[model samples]
Target: MLKDLLQTNASFEEELLEEINSLGKIVDFKSNDILIDLNEQIKGMPLLINGAIKILREDYNEGELLLYFLEKGDVCAMTMACCLGKKQSKIRAIAETDGQLIMIPISKMDEWLAKYPSWRKFVFESYNNRLDEMLFAIDNLAFNDMNQRVKNYLLDVATINKGRKIIKTHQEIANELNTSRVVISRILKALENDNILKLHRNEITIL
Candidate 1:
């Protein structure tokens, strides 16, 4: 499974692939599971095999702001920073869906960087990709209104889950968006009246 996933998604060379196969450990996570928490010591970097992970930043009052969603075939650049700097995690990572991870120990980052050109390139590209995503998040929060942000957030959820139906409660969505549950509920009700979506018990179906 690891080798096949690497071949299909990652750009690692055969030699580095062999090393990863030997050194990387496979871990599984279920939906809503906290993969990493604030101030936790960094140990290894995760290479996503399948499903989605939501990366979040902690606010001043112990709240978390959603940074971005990481899909299959992605790595967290912030996680990379933590690993390389030998520091604690500054963000929280939650499994948005059930998934598998191939965890590479921090000790091997420099080794792979020096030994494999493909690994070096992959690391740099991953960093750039994540940086772009975070920047977009910053912009969205800075300029986008709450209503548009809510709608766009639903669209994103649908796209990520590959379906029109999103299995999230208003409070959950509000928490992710760093807003009050009351605000999310009100917006959702208005959107339902607008016929943009149908709200079920705990799911929102985009129309």
Candidate 2:
């Protein structure tokens, strides 16, 4: 279900899948695999077939910040950096789970762009959409308080799971929101006391 949402559209059926299967190799990665490093030259595109991956930047002193997460059927948006001919990536990608990706050469993608303009447009839109998401995250961090930020993060995750709640550790939630597990625990306790949410072993349910 989540996978379908990531791959949404007819172009995957009409163009992407067949073309990918024809030329590229499907590569597998274990959890924590570094798909690309900061300052590395832009390669080609990777079509994620399974599992999840995160793209973020690690500053020498400022620490790490998440940029995005690409799950099953989600194409790597960094490929668009390559499309735009960017020299180096500002973000690095790491596998959040063991996964497989269809690797396509930039040269081949250029050929496809020339052959299928509509497919190219779809790919471009995917990148732009990702850019929008990044901007939103930045806005949240800049304007929202830590409590509101954490609350909003949980709400977003719940909405993503269709309001069923998220089954993840406090540390995981903290990592996603770029905060401390202790902080998250305190916040959760406050919310629980207010009868607003319930916490299980590692999950949270909105009440």
Worst 10 residues of 1 by lDDT: 1-10
- lDDT of model 2 at residue 56? 74
> Residue 94: error of model 2 in Å?
3.5
Candidate 2, residue 74: the lDDT equals: 65
Off by over 4 Å in 2: 1-17, 28-34, 40-42, 83-86, 96-99, 158-167
RMSD to truth, every model: 1.1, 4.0
Q: Candidate 2 — what's its lDDT?
A: 0.73
lDDT of 1 by residue, 1-207 (tens): 556775434467877888888999988999999999999998999999888999999899877788999888889999999999999999999999898888999999988889998888888988999999899898889999999989878988888899999999989999999999999999999999999999999999999
lDDT (Cα, 0-100) at 67 in candidate 1: 90
Candidate 1 Cα misplacement greater than 4 A, ranges: 7-9
Error of 2 at 126 (Å): 1.0
